[model samples]
Target: MASVTDLQYVALAVPDLAAEREFFGQTWGLTEVGEEDGMVYFAAEGMPHPYVIRLRRDDERKTDLVGFSAASREDVDALFEQVKAAGAKIIAEPGPVEGLAGDYGFRFFDPDGRAMEVVTGGAQRAHRTLGKGEAIPVGISHVVFHSPNHPALVEFYQRALGFRLSDWIGDFMGFLRCNSAHHRIAVLPGPPALNHIAFDVASVDELMRGLARMHESGIHLSWGPGRHTAGDNTFCYFITPNGNAVEYTSDLEHVDEATWVPTTYQPGPNTIDQWGTGRIITGNVPHAEMTPDKGLWQVPA
Candidate 1:
């Protein structure tokens, strides 16, 4: 079956581009790779996806794009056909991608109107294995979104992008996996907006060291520094300078595709945070105030 093999990048537009650039490049531990057409790109030290993040200046902070990767040009075309057949609004047909990534891809809006791209054959960068205690992201782990109609959106992802269900948090949150690191996308019921983007760190030690680094840098921790029951990942959440939520996570479970069964976990304090430290220490919960995304239904630049 044609499917997206992995998450490739997230493009964001922020009102304070300089602060966002500095925050992602310096504080968040991503390497600034290149800038083109007023957009800045950042790559993780441990991944060869060319770039993992793309940022640009805008009057309002909004998600610009979420990119995924396919194994080949054939898969890209196949996925494009599936997306079109599923009735998504197409932005561009499959073709050679513009700008630095350099690949064959297509663009479209998911059911909630967020822009997405699926590509293959991009330029790969030279990356190294990040050592323990490095306190930096290896690569993007997953992205969570808030959807007004969560079940239908989950179905859209499954039908259009060939994702499989991994688990659910009761009836409210759904985890979907493309290539078995448990989940690359999860959805919750709320307004149509992004909840957070997670980046994988080396280990629990790196997660803690990152907490200390964020504290010293004066960025407030939003929720976590604890473990989650679903993916069994340790998490620490923080808001970027432009109010975009991001997470540093470790120890995400990988599943065997041949024998995995999806579990619907009962939602509770301990289920969301197994360590019981998130609420006890930070006094913040996992839920956040969500409004419809400003960038929704708008064509990307």
Candidate 2:
């Protein structure tokens, strides 16, 4: 069966669209690529597509939907069939997306009711390489979800989308990869909410500079500027104005499916942070405030 190759984007619903735009564009350094019907798109420098994060204005703040790019158009059709065969909720029938260049896909609700899209052939945006001090993400690296029914969600992704198991933090968290960058999606045992969204950066300097830039601009981190043992990626997480977690990360471990062996790691102090130094600040925004929604783009106008 044709499979998903990599994550394309994520849609989110926020109480304030302006705050989401300013936080992602000015503070996070992402470019505002386009907007329509109160929905805004943000993209990194040199991004091939129009946007990576789609935000919609709403009364409540929450995750909207996650988009994954299939290897080809054929793969998209195949996955749609698989999703239907698995008895999941189909939100949108397979078709082209408006304002997105030649894009054809469909939307569905995951086992936990989170919206997801399988798309191919979206419009490309104008490109520019990253320069000094700009912290715009190169691309969305991964998205983590607090899935209460861990076994069911894990099984759904693996069975329907052809996602492979990367690793597990015991039964508390499980990592699944569609591509090579460790895990593109993580399912954590909890209520239906967003854990965090990660972005790729050039180097350690870039990641630290992003942290510094956010600090100078009066944006502080919720947790991180540390390394995670699982993906082996360096991270710096901060709370967005809309009360959600966003991470700037680098050096994510890439796995070779043929030789890679999945491992189960028990929860420990150092399991989450290899550095074991950053304090865990669990609170309203990145913690309690981040719930799931049908991302701004997917919600009806």
Residue 110, candidate 2: C-alpha displacement in angstroms: 0.5
lDDT of 2 by residue, 1-301 (tens): 5568888887888888887789998888788877888788888785675678889888887677788887677888999998998888899988877755237888888877777888888766777777765566888889888776977888789888989999998887889999778999888877776788989887778898998988898887777777888888888888898877889998899999889898898787588887864555554122333344434234432
TM-score of 2: 0.91
TM-score of every candidate relative to the true structure? 0.98, 0.91
Superposed on all Cα atoms, model 1 deviates from the true structure by an RMSD in Å of 0.9
Segments of candidate 2 deviating more than 4 angstroms: 126-129, 132-134, 280-301
lDDT of 2 at 110: 81
Give candidate 1's TM-score: 0.98
Candidate closest to the true structure, highest lDDT: 1
lDDT of candidate model 2 versus the reference:
0.79
Q: Whole-model Cα lDDT per candidate?
A: 0.92, 0.79
**Candidate 1 residue runs with Cα over 4 Å from true position:** 287-289
